[model samples]
Target: MSAAGGGSAGSIRIDRLLVYLRFARTRSAALALIDTHALRRNRKHVLRASEQVRIGDVLTIALGSGVRVVELLALPPRRGSPAEAASHYREVDSDGLDRKGQMTIGASSPAPGILSGDPEDFS
Candidate 1:
């Protein structure tokens, strides 16, 4: 129930975009990049982190070797978990999401300080 580069015209709140950007692992990093003027919406530089984004809006972000363009799809009211945020938009024909599936495979790990050694060894 989503389309990329094409969607029913609608307005999406700024908070939702923050969640989506976080989900994409691009918000925090994008925020830093944006500070350097590396992000654009519809060809216009986006300087504010709280700006609202609407459906069908094209977002161009600078990647390591190239730029990525994403078309906003649906908009939700509040930010959700990574899984929920992903449901809000469909990635356009861009390399930005090409490694998405690969990323989920090794996404999480045990806490850094957690140990599985013998309990008696602690004594």
Candidate 2:
């Protein structure tokens, strides 16, 4: 609606969300990613760039080598810093796809025994 961002919090256009979240450099780039047909909303294929995404909606996006599942925590008001964009959503564990997009959760962690807790975290 306004220049700042879309008004209200009901929904945001898919292409705009990708741009606001820094998933793509620009709106066109975001559209390209959508055209790949690898974007899934709640496990369903995203067929349009104008799809509206609201809070708590789960998205499975196929990145370069792996898939990333992010839950919409909030809609960003603008394309701010990386930290600001990160705050708008939460990265959640998907259906157990490892670094190479293989199932390995039951057997071991992604790095083997280094899961759950952070090693360099001293806080």
Candidate 3:
């Protein structure tokens, strides 16, 4: 079983969190992203997949040309429905903070480039 918030005050490892949050299709894909050195924690570059993330730590992962910023949230027990997974965290902005949770937080958005107000599962 995967460890849920195992380190430093209920923290989860970056790669595992990605899988749990369904950000990647699998943990290996998550690790691949980390290896690119395109991942950031609180606007700082993340060096490894094993790095731990706390409940409020903001993460930035490069996706295509854009980036996805997600705040670490409570540890999830499983990869539930897309909606269930989304509840685990909110999206952070370039300013390193969420603007009242206005940004989209999901695997896919309804539109091509813009994010919908409410996060939805297109899959």
Candidate 4:
């Protein structure tokens, strides 16, 4: 789903997407992440930085300390502020772990108030 204010409507290069979403500080960093096989799109290894990713795609990124699984809610037109970039995707607890990476007893829910609206909308 595109953003309310006319966001990009087609697939985006994964490297660019990473920068736009603030996953990486720069495009080169994003490429390095991909080169190291630290990113997976829909559970499959991302072979290149140019791999296309669209709205609703789930990305599992292995960061320095932990993993981050996020679903693209919208493709931002540019790399905006932290809050704006945050609104473009939703963090997902794919492994049923909480903030500390410990297993949870019940369903995993997105962090409250990080973004407005139901995350299930992307599902």
lDDT winner among the candidates? 4
Q: Each model's TM-score, in the order given?
A: 0.50, 0.70, 0.69, 0.70
Cα lDDT tens digits for candidate 2, 13-108: 888888787666677766766666657787677788888888888777765545668899987878887778889998888554335533321221
Off by over 4 Å in 4: 1-9, 95-123
The per-candidate count of clashes, in order, stands at 0, 0, 0, 0
Model 4 Cα shift for residue 67 (angstroms):
0.2
Per-residue C-alpha lDDT of model 1 across residues 1-123, encoded as one tens digit per residue: 222211334554332364444422334544555555655666677777666578678666554434446676766645466556557666567454444332111112222221112233122
Best by TM-score: 2
Positional deviation of 14 in candidate 4, in angstroms? 0.3
Evaluate residue 61 in candidate 2 and report its C-alpha lDDT on the 0 to 100 scale.
Answer: 70
Runs with alpha carbons beyond 4 Å of true place in candidate 2: 1-4, 7-9, 95-123
Error of 2 at 111 (Å): 29
Please list all clashing residue pairs in model 4, or write none if there are none. none
Query: Residue by residue across 1-123, what tens digits does model 3's lDDT show?
Result: 235745565677888887777766677777766766656787666778888787788777666556677776777766777778889988766685555734443233222322222345225
**What is candidate 4's lDDT per residue for 1-123, written digit by digit as tens?**
344223345778888888777777677878777776767888778998778888889887776545678899987878887788889998887564234633222212222211212334212
Clashes of 2: 0
Q: What lDDT, from 0 to 1, does candidate 1 have?
A: 0.49
Q: For candidate 3, what is the total of clashing residue pairs?
A: 0
| Cα TM-score of candidate 3 | 0.69
Q: Which ranges of candidate 3 are over 4 A from the true structure?
A: 1-9, 94-122
